[model samples]
Target: MKDTIEGFLDLVKERNGHEPEFLQAVEEVAETVIPYIVKHDIYYGKNILLRMVEPERLISFRVCWVDDSGEIQVNRGYRIQMNSAIGPYKGGLRFHPTVNASILKFLAFEQVFKNSLTTLPMGGGKGGSDFDPKGKSDNEIMRFCHAFMSELFRHIGPNTDIPAGDIGVGQREIGFLFGMYRKMRNEFTGVLTGKGMTWGGSLIRPEATGYGTVYFAENMLKTKNDSFKGKTIVISGSGNVAQFAAEKSLQLGAKVVTLSDSSGYIYDDEGIDDGKLKFIMTLKNEKRGRISEYVKEYPNAKFTKGKTPWGEACDIALPCATQNELNEDDAKTLLNNGCICVSEGANMPSTKEAIAAFHKAKILFAPGKASNAGGVATSGLEMTQNSLRYKWTREEVDNKLKDIMTDIHKSCIEYGTEEDGYIDYVKGANIAGFVKVADAMLAQGIV
Candidate 1:
């Protein structure tokens, strides 16, 4: 089994050696999915995994736009149509400086399983640019988004490929991108998600990911007859995911004590309630300010520069930050501090070692693909509403989102239970997500 895994990995590494992030994402899925294939007769000797690893299409282009300074700037943009077996390509478009083939490939690879888990008729893909939106004026961002969409428009459509928002791409950026795509195509369609409510966007789209993460965590806790009624939660990141995760946790009677950004984290022993979370929303979404300013608003909270919230003790920890933000040491610290559950709201936020540590501890740990799938699931819902030319009420959308998360949790349990009865969510998510796409690939006759 070890040799089989290594041989397959060697082949992947030969082609993607320079793409460390993509390799990491593939290796993680390979570890679990290969073992399942060995046990299943239909999947063996078919090389289905190999076919899935390679993208059907990879589009790259140069995006040139004028800045507020009246100077032209260029940035590299990419769209990795990773898989379209189950349905059309579906994923988010990030606009951070860290965007690259490696990262986007990893994201797109994970999106395959994540979308499959959602039980939605959407496939997996991810695209983004190395364009930084920070410190750029509104006109500059609009020009950059328009420029990015000019090239991206040719490859995507309402039925072909649909892109939503990620890291640096929000409602404002989506508005700009959608405006360009609409103009280029001379049509107004649901080619994009995360639009304003007044537009084609669905209700609860912004809050979906965060709300879904907490909902997943709640499901995991229920197996042990536990609940978040009095749990102390620590969440990382101050962005959409983190802020809403905090909001949902508070709504469920849990006390959220922390939120962070790139600069640092703030520890509020008294807990971040509705009023405080509103402040953070404005701070990040409106003012676009640093997290350090949180201390000035609430003197009770202590601002720790250049650190994560893992060191703080809590009953639950949601890593809502970026990839690799939580490492092994942080996992161990959380374990020592009596954290019973860790639900990821970001893509690959916890390192491989950290996951191993969590598994060793036999605690509840949900991977980003399974837990953070709400965003895309809701995006799928948005697509449906857009097609119907009708919108659902907030309660209706929220209820559907909850039902999807519950189904995802059940899927993980079905595939992840071990001989000891411990649920390995990582293993469960990978295999459960794999089976659907693998079957689709088989039926499609090696396309």
Candidate 2:
């Protein structure tokens, strides 16, 4: 079994040796999914996983735009149309300085399983550019988004490929991209999500990913006959995912004590209440300010410069920041501090060693693909709303989102249970998500 796994990984590495992030994602899935394939005769000798690892189409193009200094700038953009067996290609578009083929490929690959777990008709795909949106004027962002979409428009459609926001790409960027798509296609369609609510965007879309992570954690706790009634929670990242996870945890009677960013984490022993959360929404969404500013607004909070909040004691921890932000030492610290539950709000936030540590400790740990799927799931809902030319109320959308998260949790349990009465959610999510796509690929026959 070890040799088989190594051989498979060798093939992948040979093809993607330059892509460390992509290789890491593949290796993680292979560790669990390969064993399942070996046991399931239907999957063995099929090379289905190999086919899934390779993208159906990879589009690359140049994006040129003008900055405030009246200088022309160029950036590379890409879209990995990963798989469309179950439905259309669906994922988010990131605009960060770190965008690359390896990162986008990894994200697109994970999206395949994450979308399948959601039980949505969407498939997996991802696109992005190395363009940084920070410090850019509104006009500059608009120009870049428009240029990016001008090239992207030729390859995507409402029913072909649907893109949403990720990292640097937000509602403002989406608005510009959508505006360009509408002009080029000469029609208003849901080619993109994360739009302003007044313009065909779904309610709770911004909060869905964060809310879903907490909801999954709640379900995990329920299995142990517990709840978040008065638990202390520490969440990393101060963006959309972190803020919303904090909000939902607070609503469920949990004390959210931390929220972090690139600078560092802020620890509020008093807990971030509704007013504080509102301030965060404005700080990040409107003001575009750094998290350090949070200390000035609230004297009770202590800002830890250049450090993660994982060291802070808490009952639950959510890594809502970027990839590989939490490592083995951080996981060990959390375990030592008596933290019992960990849910991911960012893609691949926890390192491989951290995951192994969590598994060894038997803590309830969820990978980002499963825990943070709500963002894409709501994007799926937004796609549905666009097709129907109708909108759902906040209550309606929120209920659906909650139901989907509950169902995803159930799916994880159905496949992830062990003889020792422990739930290896990582294993469960990988296999459960794999089966659906594998079966679809089988039915479709070599596409």
Candidate 3:
């Protein structure tokens, strides 16, 4: 067992090759699961953790599509089905040029435990292409989506593997893919989630991640006799997750003053009202443009290039942009400005040093597995609805989502709450999530 752990460490060191953020993510989960595995007699002569770390299936394909000027372009596509012990693989399909097998593998690996933590009958999988959606015409996006889905359709199904949206892939992309899936298969099943309401998509699906994130934050705040009411919030990213997070924060009376994108962020001290938010949404979602367009659309807004406004001061920070966007430097900035709590809207958005900083500061911190789990949880619900051939009301589904998030928070606190009253959610989530899957695997008598 010791040898396996040592060997696993060596492999990680060799293959992953000293990426600070990646190593930090692995170390957090390893610290929680390895000791527990040693204590249990279930794993003997076999390194389950090491085996689980390796992907069950890693697929990469070539995506060739026509550009606006009728030029054929090629991009890489990938799908990392990390685990499926609980159920068919489920996760998001991101469409960002930064996506590669390593990043998607990490996301899918995290999804395994995150799904288990929710007590949902689902497993982990993640796929996407290196095709950037920005600056592409509608026709270009459609062509790309069709080309990508042509190959992906064979490997996924409602009862097999299901996928939804991530950063670059959203409703538009989902719509295009669903259309193609319908054309190819000639059957309309809930194989893919996040469809428009006019189609097979579930209710409250769009708002699930952001709303769930806030709900988790609220539960964490409940532990400390506080809520988001009348607190100031800063959120990075102007995409679906961040936008919805800001919306829920407003509902809870939080004065949210921040939203950003690749170009930079916009700071509106007066708070983002419904009208202003609608404008911002139009700028990003419809226009497929940058956050700098936000200031042009709305007066009394300031845009700064290559700067995050954490140092300006806030009570909560939501880093929803992408992985490692927030680092030790950002953590220090937030700590110096009196940030109280952080709820991740994007998967693994905060670096390990940043997470440690939160712990050292004794401020509330929720890991992405526990916080940003609403998205996949709702996807599970979508699968249930599809299997049953019945659609649930929006209120019913959203309420279920709320309960799942609350329960996930309880699970985190139950396993993560320290004697010192500082819950190490990283450890708590890893242990809690690992126990269920490990026990299940044991009962099944090894695969």
Candidate 4:
């Protein structure tokens, strides 16, 4: 309880009543920035933190699209432009039935700092629709994407706000959205990331977050004189992030045994190799299906219901699913199972209870703001490339992404190296990211 912004927080709690995710975010920053605000003694009551937590703009629209059966389907679409103190709003569009204002607020609030931590000229924003892509025909998906982008196009631009892919919105979705944006705006720009290679998309953008998480984990492990080699890992969420995390882990000589989806978890005693991963990509991205099919295809794998892949013996855990997927019980399972490292690929996947458990266990925990920043970092690069009308090669972009992730890891250590020698990544990421935005805010000066 640092009282740097006590009154404002109290007001929020009075109004919102124990907004755990929101309160957790504020607490994480208060522990770090309070000292700095006291030392600086400049504009304490300006409500910067309060305002930063709140979104700059929240657009909620009614999206109406016609499905393949000549039926008009309607859904709620949202774009929460959280902050723009540093640069244009940059983040992802996740289309899932679970999306709402509170969830999007938590996500967009986290994105502000995550983008800042990348050391990129980007701010924070997140957009999504509650229309689930699962069980939808390609034409239906295309119409939904087009309708969503039609409303979204008016708000986002390359130099203003940029959107990328998340859980449900992948290449096909991006293509449809981009096509709609182009048709409406009548200009070609980097309004979106995760575009096809034939378009404005950059190379290696898809693999950035997953690869970067492992890279950050490796950097953290290196301080303890170790690496990913011979490590057994359990990764949740068999999406793009989890798939590439598996790929990178194999490349780093680690074995990943489990990957899950919304339905349930799949446990493979043997490692999830490239073949299995390809099957997953097809299953998830192409077929738009569940992960239980993975077990059916591989007789050696076992599918379990209503449980995560934790409790299996492992050295590392990567939770790539949505927020609050991992809780206190899951953290205890990981700790009891001898898991040492936890890096988040999704935004705030671990709850406060889970984080406290890891802290109590003294495990190496990297927050999504620090670990999963690779995606937005590359999105910023995409902006730069779009500005210059050039595309960097995969190796070139990947090398730079690696450097950025390393720098982010170093930044966390530099700021998070505390008296107890445990890195408070929440503090490190919030403080480190805040400095850049705070400076920009100061320079802009009463604008």
The model with the greatest lDDT is 1
Pairs that collide in candidate 4 are: none
Give candidate 4 regions above 4 Å deviation: 1-6, 15-24
The full ranking of all candidates by TM-score, starting with the best, is 1, 2, 4, 3
lDDT of each: 0.96, 0.94, 0.85, 0.86
Candidate 2 residue-wise lDDT at 354: 97
Q: Report the candidate with higher lDDT, 2 versus 4.
A: 2
Report model 2's TM-score to 2 decimal places.
0.99
Ten residues in sequence with the least summed lDDT for candidate 2: 438-447
lDDT (tens digit, per residue) of candidate 1 on 95-139:
999899999999999999999999999999999999999999999
Per-residue accuracy of model 4 over 1-447 as CA lDDT, tens digit each: 345467656766675564667666666666577666666656365656766766789999999999888989899999999889898898899899988777777778888888888888888999898999988888999999988988899899987999999888888899999999999989888899989988888888899899988988998899788999999999999888998989999999999999998788999998898898889999987677899998889989999987777768899999987778899998998999999999998888888889989988888999998999988888778778888989999899999999999999888887788897888776777778888887888778755
Model 1: worst 10 consecutive residues (lDDT sum): 438-447
Q: Residue 400: error of model 3 in Å?
A: 0.8
Each model's TM-score, in the order given?
Answer: 0.99, 0.99, 0.95, 0.95
Q: What clash count goes with each model?
A: 0, 0, 0, 0
Candidate 3 all-Cα RMSD: 2.1
lDDT ranking of the models:
1, 2, 4, 3
Model 3 lDDT per residue over 3-31, tens place: 75566677876877745444556767887
Clashing pairs in 2: none
What stretches of model 2 exceed 4 Å from their correct place? none
